[model samples]
Target: MPFYSCFAHSLIQNGYHYSRKSPWTASQNIAAVESLGICHSFVLHCIISSFPGLPLVNPIPTKSLEGKSLIIRVFIEQFYENLEEATIGRWLKAEGDRVGDQEPLVEIITDKITFELPAPGSGVVRSIISREKSVVPVGCVIGLLGEPDDPLPDVSAENRATLERRQREVESQALIPSPETVAPEASVSERVRDRGKVRATPAARRVARENGMDLAEVAASIGGGLIQEEDVQRWIERRGSST
Candidate 1:
């Protein structure tokens, strides 16, 4: 027979034997047996069934910028290339300050050309994102100023394309040689000729000329040959004593 049928037959035989010796009513005995069977089924299910795995949940907090009045976004100079020591002149706005639209935020000077960068809108200067003397690329944010609840202005694809074009133009200008390049124009021949004509003390000259040595050679030996009177005297004394 099937396992369940065999088990039920055994339970019926035990119940009949127990009923003959017990004084309980038929309904009460049957109810008690059914309750025991239910308990056994629950235990069996608990042992045989595998539990389902649950995934973990994480909560993240949101950032809020609510009540600020103004934010200034300082952009890099469109025409400026390298930021030399003299590029930054002065700051027109301070931290935690209020400013008007088109007001000067900073003065920048490059190669004798000075520019006053204007504020984009009227609002309090919330923060200075870039420090003084820092070199920032064109279109990079240097500061942010705006009302607290105002959403950040998006740099759209078109605006980004324009900024990139302007940046390329500025970079092309920077690639051009500056006037400082003219300072190194003196040729090697000019330097050698200048060195050959350098004046020396009489004694040094006598020693060099007598030894059939070039003054340039002597100067090259004695660290650029700025021959002092003492050097000349020493050379003369050494020459006389050597003979």
Candidate 2:
């Protein structure tokens, strides 16, 4: 059965109206439906499937210009449940470039990984709202798309303020080592261990000790270098340190 048909039938069977507006929010509605033992993904799928004409996942409809055309607002889609913000790595298509539906548009980097976000629909890239390396909250508009002649829609102050707030929060948070802090795969090298000491040069050893970093860990990270002061400095940068 089609998702909307099956879901509507289930709701009707449980004494709910498909077209009637409920007092509950969307999340509340989902939760209420799930109480009937429906799978969460299935319920969410049905909700999205019901909206065939709407680009609810990534595009927001801008105010129709004289009722002629609607602009698509491109946003950073949330790929992970726990991810709230991401950095705009770079834009593949700049303003005025024609793009097809689902073409790779921009690179987005989260704490876990970097991935390309696709264009929501076919149109010319009308405006680039967020620049490269900007840290924006998920669902924040990073660009806009429409016909080449369409006027650029104004981004509301509220949305820009929200992005600013998220950036500030991220900046004020304490630094911590993330998965990217360490190399993903170990390289080929024997552990530089000798007489209960990490086999590092004097300068490397001195720098590591002063920074309170373990030289063995540094040796293991690089895999083959004879651990130099430069190596320690690079490691510090990767570790999110200013020193």
Against the true structure, what is each candidate's TM-score? 0.34, 0.42
Q: Write the per-residue lDDT of candidate 2 for residues 29-123, one digit (tens) a residue.
A: 44334344454233353464344442111111332123333456676766888789889998999888998767899999999999998776567
What lDDT tens digits, residue by residue, belong to model 1 across residues 25-88?
3222222233233321222322212211111111112321223212334555446455423345
Cα lDDT for residue 200, candidate 2: 67
Off by over 4 Å in 2: 1-66, 161-243
Question: What are the root-mean-square deviations of the candidates from the true structure over C-alphas?
Answer: 29.8, 15.2
In angstroms, the error of model 1 at 93 is 6.6
Q: Against the unseen true structure, what C-alpha lDDT does each candidate score?
A: 0.50, 0.65
Best by lDDT: 2
Cα-based lDDT at residue 40, candidate 1? 17
